[model samples]
Target: MVSEAQLRTIIAEAVPTIDAAKLPADVAFADSGIDSLDYAAILLALQERHGLVVPDEDLSRTASIAGILAYAAEHRSDA
Candidate 1:
């Protein structure tokens, strides 16, 4: 199972400006200056790294780190 900590690292890599450890889980990425492009890249990185199939309709729910963690928990593949 992929832990939340690993997800945090993935998020940190996708948005290089912010330190994931310092970021709160519930805060939106926009709070940290992440734009739409950054968010999209984050989604792409998650899909590529973890083989997660986050539908377009579901993408809005993943605007925050905690949200991403939740989505990954539900949809992550057993790779």
Candidate 2:
């Protein structure tokens, strides 16, 4: 089970400008100081590292940390 702490590391790696650990779980990435490009990088990292893939159509569903966790819980595959 992935935790918020782990996600914060991913976020920090994806965007080194901000303190990912301090970011709000409910805040959307765009509203939490993450730009589109950084958000994309974070998503890609999630896919590559954790196998959590967010398709184009469901992009809106995973805009925040909470949303990402929920999506990962629902869709993540260990295969």
Candidate 3:
């Protein structure tokens, strides 16, 4: 099973500027320098990693790493 820590690593890799070890889950993507295009790229990478399709509406609900972790926890098939 991919733990939240692992997910954090994946996310950090997607957004290279954000330091995963120091970032709290509640930190907003915008505050962390993750713009819309970066967010889209992160989503694409996450979808490929987790094998899950995130609808646009569903993606709208997530604005932080915590949100993505929650979505992955709920939808990841590899779990």
lDDT top scorer: 2
Tell how far residue 52 is off in model 3, in angstroms: 2.5
For candidate 3, the lDDT comes to 0.74
CA RMSD of all predictions:
1.9, 1.5, 2.1
Q: Scored by CA lDDT, what does every candidate get?
A: 0.77, 0.86, 0.74
The candidate maximizing TM-score is 2
Estimate, for each residue in 1-79, the C-alpha lDDT of model 1 and write its tens digit. 3467877787788778878778888988888777888888877877777776678898788888888878777765631
Clashes of each: 0, 0, 0
Q: Which window of ten consecutive residues has the lowest lDDT sum in model 3?
A: 70-79
Q: Candidate 3, residues 1-79: lDDT per residue as tens digits?
A: 3466776777788778877767778888888878898788777776676665678888765678788777767766644
Q: In model 2, which runs have C-alpha deviations exceeding 4 angstroms?
A: none
Q: After superposition, how far is residue 7 of candidate 1 from its true place, in Å?
A: 1.9
lDDT (Cα, 0-100) at 47 in candidate 2: 79
Q: With candidate 1 superimposed using the best TM-score fit, by how many Å does residue 43's alpha carbon deviate from the native?
A: 0.7
